[model samples]
Target chain A: MTESVLASWREGPVKQAIVDFVALATTPGPGFVAVADRIATFDNDGTLWVEQPLPPQFDFVFRRWAQEIKQDPSLAEQQPYKAIIARDPAFFAGVATQDPEVVGALLAAFARTWKGTTPEEFDAQVREWLQTVKQPKLGVPYIELVYKPMLELLDLLRAHEFRVFVCSGGGRDFMRVFAEETWGIFKENVIGTAAEYRYADGRIVRAEHALGSLNVGPGKPEHIFAQTGRLPALAGGNADVDIEMLEAARFSVLVSHDDEEREFAYTSGGEASLARAKELGWTVVSMKDDWITVF
Target chain B: MTESVLASWREGPVKQAIVDFVALATTPGPGFVAVADRIATFDNDGTLWVEQPLPPQFDFVFRRWAQEIKQDPSLAEQQPYKAIIARDPAFFAGVATQDPEVVGALLAAFARTWKGTTPEEFDAQVREWLQTVKQPKLGVPYIELVYKPMLELLDLLRAHEFRVFVCSGGGRDFMRVFAEETWGIFKENVIGTAAEYRYADGRIVRAEHALGSLNVGPGKPEHIFAQTGRLPALAGGNADVDIEMLEAARFSVLVSHDDEEREFAYTSGGEASLARAKELGWTVVSMKDDWITVF
Candidate 1:
């Protein structure tokens, strides 16, 4: 017998579903998907990696906001910056709940951090940040916090000729910096929300505003179609923002953050998605029940 | 000796440069790009197919506009639609010159024709159009009108493990319908101008306005970087619209439509690009001199 590709995953329904899907896709059978059509997409923040305490991207942006506030001092008076600097738990809770005003403030700050830099320069800044900063709760670099079982699943999908894509609500260019090294997914396959870019002085530079809709909620399917021109054959996510993306796929997998001891537990933002997964017969993988390892 | 991959291309400086570039990229040596970084972008219209008389996309749109005008004659009074309906040579001349007003009007009309349709429906319509609509001058279906030499070059690039992408000024969703069958490039690999999409009532629908910048001139590199997160390693184009795309690439190839007898001749729009190619020491493949076949 062939050794299991997702050895980190416990042998059960979740692992069985994944293996069965791969077999249906790869083997000579009635429902076999052609190699070109075997596209799989995974949500980045809470799905592929840890998003506990706060999203790693938001942490990165908050640190930059702190630096900006330190320089300008007056920036702390700004609506969002004031809340951020005050360490208001209510403000952080708003972000956790994905409240519109809070989310908009976060996106605005995120956009401003890398606005004028060329892609190369932005990438260098991200690399520098990755080297120096560690996740507050995980006590490791953000990249190292990615789930081991999920990484194995990505490899399993690739070995079966499925073209894997990292679909994220995080910054597109930001994800590209580590996607190739950490995820083994090519930069071209990383689709996410992007700031507008302009060509000036013989190089492309990120503009001050976003190019289009954020790659979350219904926007996920729209962006996916715009970039890849196909609905994913398989999709994975762990949050409400990813519900539409999962629904668009033929097979949907929802990762449940039910492991409090090994990994942080969360049922707040993803409640609706978790409920939908149950109603739709989508596979729900329990981190505590189905996985033996984290990171 | 192995037969040349680009046999349809004449043995000349242009052909030699391509072969040499592929060799350098594929062989283990200094400046050898790994397969992961071997990204090659191509302009669609005249570079890959016959774009003379009118761009095939314009032809597709104009036909739709005519149908729309027939249903509602008042549409014929609209600024651009009026010009298109009259077949005014000056209007076409303005388009050839890329007059901003004329081009904006054209894009607006193009966007409206397929707005509100699902991608699958848009694709089905495009497939139907391809079956019926033949290039006016060439008298062959648009798919078959693709350049034979360019097809050979694409195959050659793929053989060297270069990931080929069609970066076009045409509609992205429109091109995806034919890219797989016509260019042997996958749908995911074709990046082009895109309309905004909305998710409504469980299906993704094309929205009225463009999602971002038009993929022409400086917009090409901006869109390319936005989607792929990398500057193309190699690029090919045939017009001023493609100038910046070619400029952004490590190696640039300009296809000069200097052949009048076999293929339509055009030195008008592409003259500056042709001149820049010479000044920058970029490869210029003459349709008259280099290609033994056009389609």
Candidate 2:
């Protein structure tokens, strides 16, 4: 039964590339070598999972911000807050491209708001939020909507003795909230953007996270190299920004979204960024032609 | 030959604890718990290496300060600068204990000073310092004076499938400087006190870490629990501060410095601290009885 399931998915060029990668990683030799200690890095938003109107993290954050604004009317006057209050998702996402200064300021505000708590305190709040929050599109728990394929890939890589890491462009603390339970990736291995913390008065205090540019494609590889001092053995992505990270990997796979019937087809939209992974020499896995299942 | 070398060492209760730890970790289980993932945490400084007059890290910091001061004599007139110029090692170590406000103010000053640089830049500077710094007593490079027996134990644990880590009172950044080269322990796994960083001007800017209370013995367990969320299977320590960490481990070992004639016999001047470890029923190993070589 398991062999039939595996064989069912093994019918494309991308599948062949995956087979080759698995073979090299398992085979022991000098030339076709697989470094046992090798790590494989994957991008989160729009790569491993879906990123439509905005990433799920931003959706959660904005929702939290809206709740806070109800308690304090003054935040409505703030620039980014005002943009958010006006329900301008485009303006908020384009804050980096339009006026970069706002990005840093917004990040600082976000960091200051959540700094200096114990792990228990933070985790409890995250758990509470996850229990309460629901995805508008799916009408299900946000955690349930996590890409099933990526979860399987994570398990498969770990089985082969590969250290798989999620090098996301999302907030480190935010990603950490669900990373362990939802993905099985530990907090230490999950690298992302961070807000600062200040310890004082027998308590952990949040410092302003001077946010500016999110760690996108090229920056993903840069951060990984800085933290781990290693280039990944395998890398996966689904967008133009991910090209740099994939190019740096020994084996690269690109998931191309072409199944409109099974999954939402994303080409390029007025608000959303265009996908450009095809030009990066990545083994393109078409949703319709490559993957047997969307999940 | 290896057995003979181990037999030459004095036997102690902690030695047996280590043996038991190795045995339990290697025993196969449902999830494939192997020695490579056993994850043994160790304390650095007095535990793994010599830390007499002051930790070697402080020595480097003081020397660098002096060099910087020589180039700018005006620093002699400044408050902490004047104290630093006085060349009082005791005063320096007691800076926080003596005046809590001074530590906070100094950390603030450092945060402003280091506002825009990559982690790589700081790592490079630390590497340079390690290359130049020599231990006063051993006359060996500070990095080389790491206890030979402990090095073997790390290798043995790794051989048995244990992931060796450092959970110390020292600065996290300091451990990262040499853990990889000296012990094959990656920087991420070595949890310790840390200074916060801020992102500014396209780089990760480090702030001064004003550690109010060091991650001393009991605090060592706190650090490990808070950071990694995994209680170690085994831990080794040299002094009273090691007791808490040792106590938290499934199998704990304390290196008793009873061989005054062979190696420097010393302990942190705190009786109650070690007494607490004894009350916890932890395994204590006499160095004279447990180690064949002092390195």
Estimate, for each residue in A1-295, the C-alpha lDDT of model 1 and write its tens digit: 1676788988898899889988987888877888878889999998998887778877777788889999999989875899977878888767545688887887677666777788778788888888888877668888888999999999999988889999988888889999988999889999888888898667988787877877888878888888888889999999998999999888899999999888888798899999999999999999999997887
- What tens-digit string does per-residue lDDT give for candidate 2 at B1-295? 2563344355565666666556666776643443323658888876688776567776766676677678888866764566766765554655424356566545544454443545677678788888887887667777877878788788887777677788777777667777777888765577766664443333345545432245664456655554444457788876665666776666676666666765567655435445755787666666676787777
TM-score of chain B of 1: 0.94
- For each candidate, the alpha-carbon lDDT, in order, equals 0.86, 0.64
| Candidate 2, B-chain TM | 0.81
Number of the predicted model whose DockQ against the real structure is largest: 1
Which parts of model 2 are misplaced by more than 4 Å? A1-10, A25-37, A94-100, A108-113, A197-214, A217-219, A240-244, A267-279, B1-40, B52-145, B148-163, B167-188, B191-258, B268-286, B289-295
The sequence of per-residue lDDT tens digits that candidate 2 reaches over residues A1-295 is: 1343334354767666776676677777642534434678887776666666567777777777888788887988876678877877666656434346667567655754565556567668777777887766556666776666666667767767777778777766666777777778766567676544443333343455432235664566755654454567888777655666777787777766676776567754311222344454567767677666655
User: Which CAPRI tier for candidate 1?
Assistant: high
**Where does the lowest 10-residue lDDT sum fall in candidate 2 chain A?**
A269-278
